[model samples]
Target: MLKAIIMLILGLSVLAAGFITLKRELSIEAFSISSADEAKSEMKNIFNDQRWFYLSGIALFMQFVFQGFHLTFEYFFYAFLISSGIQSLFYLFNKKELDYKVCGVIIVSFLVIYL
Candidate 1:
């Protein structure tokens, strides 16, 4: 019972985060649209901001929903691992460091496969 409740809360929280991030992105999009030519000039920065965070939040929500509510600690751990891996991969890729990207991708891929 406790486990299910916790899972529900976490799932909702992740879901909320996804929505919030999406809202922020929409607001930014609106800004860009209203700013005329200036927005297009800085298109790169606007689009890239916080996109990964929103994606990972959605991934986290999916992890719980797909795994189903359970009492086992492994589910919780795996959910976190997958969510974290997604976020980390986003970070590494964004950093544009080849060595870190290679290692991070390998680790994330292995964890994702386990899912």
Candidate 2:
């Protein structure tokens, strides 16, 4: 019972985080678009922003949901792992700096898998 509650909370939190991040990155302007041109511009900006955070948040939330339901969740974890790995590589390749947060995600993911 406790585990299920925790899992539900975690899932909701992740989903909320994704929405909050998207809100922060785009601001209210994202919701105030008045034309197709403005919408397209916002879409482009969103795509170029820290999109991986929200994407991975969704994946993690799904994993938690699956676990709560006593269903398979490994696929969601793998999805998160692959996306996080790619995002971290992009950080390294583009900025010539390792994204420690993403690296941490990768490490946690591996630990989750093995342990």
How do the residues 53-82 of candidate 1 rate in per-residue lDDT, one tens digit apiece?
Answer: 544445445445555644356644545644
Candidate 2 lDDT over 40-94, as tens digits, reads: 9888985875657654764565455544644356656554654555444444344
Residue 6 in candidate 2, Cα distance off native in Å: 10
Candidate 1 lDDT (Cα, 0 to 1): 0.50
Off by over 4 Å in 1: 30-78, 81-115
Best by TM-score: 2
In candidate 2, the residue pairs with backbone N, CA or C atoms under 3 Å apart (3 or more residues apart, or in different chains) clash, namely none
Q: Candidate 1 — worst ten consecutive residues by lDDT sum?
A: 104-113
Clashes of each: 0, 0
Best by lDDT: 2
lDDT of each: 0.50, 0.54
